[model samples]
Target: MDVLIVGAGPTGLTLGIDLARRGVDALVVERAEALFPGSRGKGIQPRTQEVFEDLGVLDAIRAAGGPYPVRAIWKDGERIGEQPMFEPVEADESAPYTEPLMVPQWRTQEVLYARLVELGGRVAFGHELTGLEQDAEGVSARFADGSAVRARYAVAADGGRSAVRRALGVAMTGETVDPSPFLVADLRMTGLDREYWHTFPRPDGTGLALCPLAGTDDFQLAGKFPEGTEFDLSLDGVRRLVAAYTHLDAEDVTELRWASDFRPRAALADRFRVGRVFLAGDAAHVHSPAGGQGLNTSVQDAYNLGWKLGAVLKDGAPEPLLDTYEEERRPNAAAMLGLSTGVHRGEVQRGKATVQLGLGYPESALSEDRRAAPAGVRAGDRAPDGRVDGVRLFDAFRGPHWTLLGAPAAAAGVHALPAAPKSYGPGVFLVRPDGYVGWAGDSAEGLGAYLARAGVR
Candidate 1:
């Protein structure tokens, strides 16, 4: 294959789909025989949805995952203010796929897998990347089954304990500060009065939460057990924690499913990529599951890099374009890690309307205009989806395209911008394919100069 991707988790699968859509040949190798199950990543952010829309599977995703908003409440023996839930996207903006969806990590993978299949690509389940060796031309990989695979480029989407990262001798350094234990499970509750999730502080570390699946009435609960006590999400642990925390008696409830005693960790990789081998998703980052951003962030990373990789392989994009993957994604991952950590430590409460939606791309090729805002148009920023004057830019997270939105030089590309050049000054603007402004004139009067500056010859 042209590209070899390790680990068919959410990130890897999504990248595989993207590569196929771009007409790039890709093969994904996953260790597991099947995709993940249950509700691991329960929340999805607006940025993630934008990536989905760009993939052209947003409709399927919305059909599979949810149009539901996941909420967080204080467990200090009382409820508090909640984010004022609004429509997925406001009418004034360019971002079409706005709002978070509450779906399990496994289901997200399933949707991505379907997209890949539709695009004529398939994942190699049960085939694992045991080791890897790379040189100038390409990367050679050895699998657990005594098999080898080679490709022009290989992405270590294999996840946090990436075998590929280890083969490259890349070291990760960080503190496992809060190694708290929590019992988690997906069970079919016989019946419940209400349909919302709950988290309360009990005598143990943290009381717990019952996040129900998006469509099904069945519920999944996770709670911190006592330090000295054995932890398990088995039927016994569920009954024990539920009985201890809530007044409802769950003994009559059948124990449908159970997850072994597991402790999710929070940490970050020191570096993301090394040489010809690139790291994406959990292979490049690890963090707490607060806000359920882990899966979402990882999937988005794949979305950002897959197109760039395809562009490099097929369109002869510049080398610097690939470097932007780490430059643009690291900070976003760091931000997500920070927010998730606060939630894990119970340091702060999260609202659905938190500015997580406004997360932007901080890296861009555009030169800085002293008078212009540093992040006026960035690499990782939300690619606004809407209309520019009478022209529609992005229906979703549309990115810069050479095929469209090209102006002579001084015409500025601004979404829903109606101001005329006379009133807006002489500056010219061009919108990127992703619904971001690429070139900007000094002022409305600088239109010709701006076009000249941006090489709009």
Candidate 2:
């Protein structure tokens, strides 16, 4: 196997599918044999949907589920302000893919699992990664089966304990601040007028939030608490909260589905890559699910790493490209952490990049001389989309693959692939499989210059 993936959850499955789609040999090993039907997260961000569309999973996702409706916040069972969960995305036909759509996390996982199987790569069930040993060329992973498999690299998409990360000796450092306990319950709401999100506040001031299930009036209730205050809500406890928070009564609580407690965790690994062993998704960083960014960030993390790993392992192995896995993503990780913990991404990232964001970095091998900006969009950054022949390429066509967004003639300097986007973002821009602008070219000269610097020449 080219890569051994730990944890057959969303992130691992996504990584496996991406690598397999590109003809890379990758295997995902899960501790369990069957797909987890209990859905923890149901809200798929629009940005996430954009990614799904790129992966060719959006239509199936939308068909299986529905859209994410605007949700309401609540405290002590009282309604408060609504959140900016989803925005109206202008349907841009010229783009590679479409905007966001919402679905259950299990649905998302199932789609990726099916796709991986379709691509001739399957997730090994009951193969929990218990240990790892690596050398200069490859790594051998020990599973609970008392057997081991060798691969050039390993992706630790496993949950927090992360056997792969520990084996590699990567240090993850951060404070577990505000240990605000919260529980998420996913289920269908019955016997109520199907309306927008219903929110309420906890009077005791422990914590508060109420949101509509993605695309429906079904509910996902969130409650925060300080220290210990019966954080885990039982079916009856959940029913009580629903009744107190809204006018709905206990009898209306049709189903008391899966529920679990989690602390608002915020942390970042000191390193994402250590030789052949790397980390992606929750394994590297765990933050509060408050902003609905955990799963989305994990998907993007794998998206960013998959192509680079494939490039290095296959052909056109640019040594410098591997270094970018940390340079570009570390800061991005920091920004995500700051957002969840209320640290903020400084003024620049907040004011400019927060909206029309692009990537920025100081030490990217992709950006040598010639003075373009950094790798990812930070503060004061405006996101750049693509266009071709005066036609704008929107979010409909983007998938988890390399995309060219200009006339093949105009997009010189970069890899002159046979197919390209007619009208996309900036002039001669190279979008990472994860949908961030990696290499930018203003004109033919800039394109040529950047390609030369990036060793694409």
- The lDDT leader among the candidates is 1
- Per residue, candidate 1 scores C-alpha lDDT tens digits across 1-457 of 6799998888888888788877888899888888776666666677677667777777777776665543445444455534333334453454444556767666677788888898899888888777789888888999889989989888988877888888888776545635566666777765443345555555546667666677555566766665555764567667766766765566834765646345656666666767678888877778766556788788768876786787678766565667767776777787778777777776755554332556656455432232254333332334455454555544522432321232332333223243322322333344443333444444444444433443332
Candidate 2 Cα lDDT to native: 0.63
Give the alpha carbon lDDT tens digit for every residue of 165-217 in model 2.
78888888887756556767765666443345554545665544444555444
Q: What is the C-alpha RMSD of each candidate to the true structure, in Å?
A: 4.9, 4.9
- The CA lDDT of each predicted structure is 0.64, 0.63
| Residue 378, candidate 1: C-alpha displacement in angstroms | 6.3
Name the runs in model 2 displaced over 4 angstroms. 72-100, 207-210, 215-218, 231-234, 240-247, 343-363, 368-386, 390-435, 440-457
TM-score of each: 0.82, 0.80
The CA lDDT at 451 in model 1 is 37
